[model samples]
Target: MELQQMRYVVAVAETANFTRAAERCHVVQSALSHQIARLERELGARLFDRTSRRVHLTPAGEAFLPAARQALEAAERARAEVAAAAGEIRGRLAIGAIPTVSSVDLPRLLVNYRTRYPRVHISLRSAISEEMIEQVKEGTLDVAVLGLPPAGRVVGLRGHELARGGLVAIVAPGHRLADAGEVALAELADEEFVDFPTGTGARVQSDDAFEAAGVRREVAFEVNAIEFMTRFVRHGLGVGMVPTAFADELAGVRVLRITDATARVEVLVWSRSRPSPPAAALLELFDIDPESYS
Candidate 1:
């Protein structure tokens, strides 16, 4: 029932090897095994089904894992809260962002936050907007920078709009529409497109626009990365649409104004409850009131 025992179990479950779990917990294998055995005896349920080759969580372990993680996080947050009361901010800050985030200079912001709070641990990950938003809601991510269609809304979380702008069409220099200064969605409907995967927040703006305009376009290349989309357009694989701010960064492609394009909105979002102290500080840097979210 000790927190240390729970930690050992979690480590074992995550690494799936007693030896590696012991290494991660900074204990000898025998000691780690003995602790887990004692814990199992106390609970009267084996947590792991262990073999020489692999370790798998037992049904009981699977049930206990979530509570164990929550307990650990609660304990850590308790300590962080105490430190924050004493004017010291020390906690883990997990941040997520879309790959095409352009509203804020993320690297510079991270650098500034790090300089101001050297004791805080920080991690950043790149994901699609939908995934990042879900992580934020799940408490796995403290904050996120997300891009969605202008009409999209953030439910069950607090979000602040950072920037909004229309998408620009990109084409290869030799393409028929390359020289066109502006084109409508219907005009591009007959052209093949290179775009983000279907249903991604990045792709939805264009999708909604085309649908609203009653135009059906062919996505010849479904790419997960913006660079790849631009590359496909550059090589004449297909035309593509990107945020107006991001379009200038892509080389070897012609940027065209979309006369009837949907706008992309970049937003900063955090959990309405349980944002860590470091997350609060970062939000303060952006002049956002975290308490309002709560």
Candidate 2:
């Protein structure tokens, strides 16, 4: 079937209605229906089952959905490759990061990259670690910064370790431990905690740090947003785990290094493949080595 026909089929499959699908594809309903009918004739199988009131994918259509999506993606990628080979770095690059880094790191990095490559359009999306990884794999994101362990995963991508520093305890500026520069994780065993949401990179790191140090954290709050955690920590809700950069910036919060040697987190740069020149240029601005930032 022709690419146009496949596009029609995909649109119809997604919307499950001819009129809405046509609107999405910027075509008339009659034209879209005709294209799908032609495609079905060529394949000798009906792709969808439609009645007066309902429309749904047939078994064959369900099976073909993924393959059709891949074909479209491959076609788009081929066009992008040609555009890049022509020495024109002028396509949208979608980059994602976890919330903490997005706030602390990306603003400067993006500004510098834009200055250097003004022709290259850039879009930044922020999410927790799990969401970012999925977006990368699904091609919604060109690259992402996440906190997955460096094992038991495919390696078509490259990862750069940017910064390595231990987790620190953060509290309101006037709290008892606020004046301390170094504190053990276990020392706050009875303290209330503001924690990262479940299934996030920061949460995972926080859990690992406590487990390694043989400390059981009593979490009074488990939140999905870093901003909430920051606000709560500032109001003396409890201690929280935050990136070193974030801890340094929050005006009314005090950060104390974890005395336990095992409590550490590393900032990483990751991409599904070797990044485009624009992304690579942006990544270069980060100080992966702790000594450089220090």
Candidate 3:
């Protein structure tokens, strides 16, 4: 019924302990319990099954939980919108980034943003591209810089390309493939490959290319970081693919072009819904006329 009751219910559902939920809500146990009891009585359904040991959400509670959280999020968003409209740019900006976007100039970008908006607090979190995209969709992350879909489209987001480059094959300096100027992806089908882990940006790009070419890669090493992939390839462990920008920097490896089918596009993605002021400002600063996808 009341927003406070909704908060209490959600807290109890998450912690699974009334005492802890009451503590989190910053109210006495009896008051929180009484309000929840009143809410259940009005709704005519038991939200939780209380045994002395552990609290469990009843079927009704499970059904109510998501909506309660949505309502809470909506209220918070409304408050942020009001503040932003009133020219208050002094709010926290939670940014998500992928560690391997070497050419993005993240340090410079953050520095400039901080210089321009000194009152705004900035927090950057490193995550795989896929995780960042999902968190942005969920409104947990204000914006993300990620290796994005080739066409630059996300279901619930508005984004634009930050940087675009083709992928290159890397091999040990003296390896057989090192001198090969450019090779087709199909040529590497029979070769042992070092690749990114599943659900990652590079992996997704590689997988789509392989599937489109009607071939499969024998991924002998599945590592998460591009640094590790290049290192392994340099040791003659396996051949690997990486963004062209970073391929030349690997000292022990010789870079070869993956002809036709290997490219990466880094996109700046944000929720399509009304974004907070700081997020909008960053997008405006980055989305230039030449490379804007949205």
Candidate 4:
């Protein structure tokens, strides 16, 4: 019946193991078990089926789980609201992004944040979209700036689009497609491609295009950085995608427009789970229109 009991039940349902749930709740297993037993007795129902090898939620547990989760979430939201009203927004905020995020103007954003919340610490890291999403889910990252695939599924995270534009093909000036202003997606199907690994935003855009056109290109090289990909394209290692601005910076390359590829704008993603005080305060700076997401 208590909030602590609700936490224990939810953790157990998620982990499917009493010991792991106890660990997650930062409580001894016996105490968690005792609370659950008391709750079951109060409700006059068995919440779980604990057999020889594994534990499974019983029918009653399944029905009660959603209500329990909602109650916990409501409680947390109340706490956050209280903290926000008191201006208690000071803590570390971990952020992750891919190399393509250079366009995000992070310096300006950080400066603004520092001016408002001088006590809050911020850390940024470069990672692929998948790794960033995982870190956010694990509570290691407060935010992630990524170029997810067009309409790609992002669960348990709220995202706000930063910028949206088409992706372009970059090639050495001497390449056959250099003089072309634009080309179909299938035209480069046979070319060797030097691109970011699978989880990157650029890779997602490229993969989605190829899959839609039913064309497959050979990825000759998978580079970890956008700078490396740009270098590889200049050396004729293969054609690759580059942002229009980035293409201009890379110089010497033919930045041909892509006709069939979809360019999903980069997005700032954060967990829907309760954020720390600093994370919540920083999120406010994004000026997000929650209704747009609705």
Please provide TM-scores, in order, for all candidate models, with all chains considered together.
0.93, 0.73, 0.70, 0.67
Instruction: Report the Cα lDDT for residue 139, model 2.
Output: 68
Candidate with top lDDT is 1
| Candidate 4: stretches off by over 4 Å | 1-88, 289-294
Candidate 2 residue-wise lDDT, 141-229, digit = tens: 77677654323232444556544555667889888988888888778888989998876777877877777788888888988776788
Which whole-number lDDT from 0 to 100 does residue 255 have in model 1?
90
Error of 3 at 98 (Å): 3.1
* Top candidate when judged by TM-score against the true structure: 1
Q: Kindly provide the TM-score of model 1 when superposed on the true structure, using C-alpha atoms.
A: 0.93
How would you encode candidate 4's per-residue C-alpha lDDT over 1-294 as one tens digit per residue? Answer: 899998999899999999999999899999999999999999999999997678889999999987997787567556756766787655567889888774568889999998998867789998888889888886668888987766876787888877777778998888999999998889998899998886566787888888888998899899988788878888898999866656567766788988887876788888886566777677788886443553
lDDT of 3 at 102: 66
Scored against the true structure, residue 40 in model 3 reaches a CA lDDT of: 99
lDDT (Cα, 0-100) at 52 in candidate 4: 69
Against the unseen true structure, what C-alpha lDDT does each candidate score? 0.90, 0.72, 0.83, 0.82
Per-residue lDDT tens digits of candidate 3, residues 26-74? Answer: 9999999999999999999999999989999999999998898888767
Q: What lDDT does candidate 3 reach at residue 253? A: 85
TM-score of 2: 0.73
Best to worst by lDDT, what's the order?
Answer: 1, 3, 4, 2
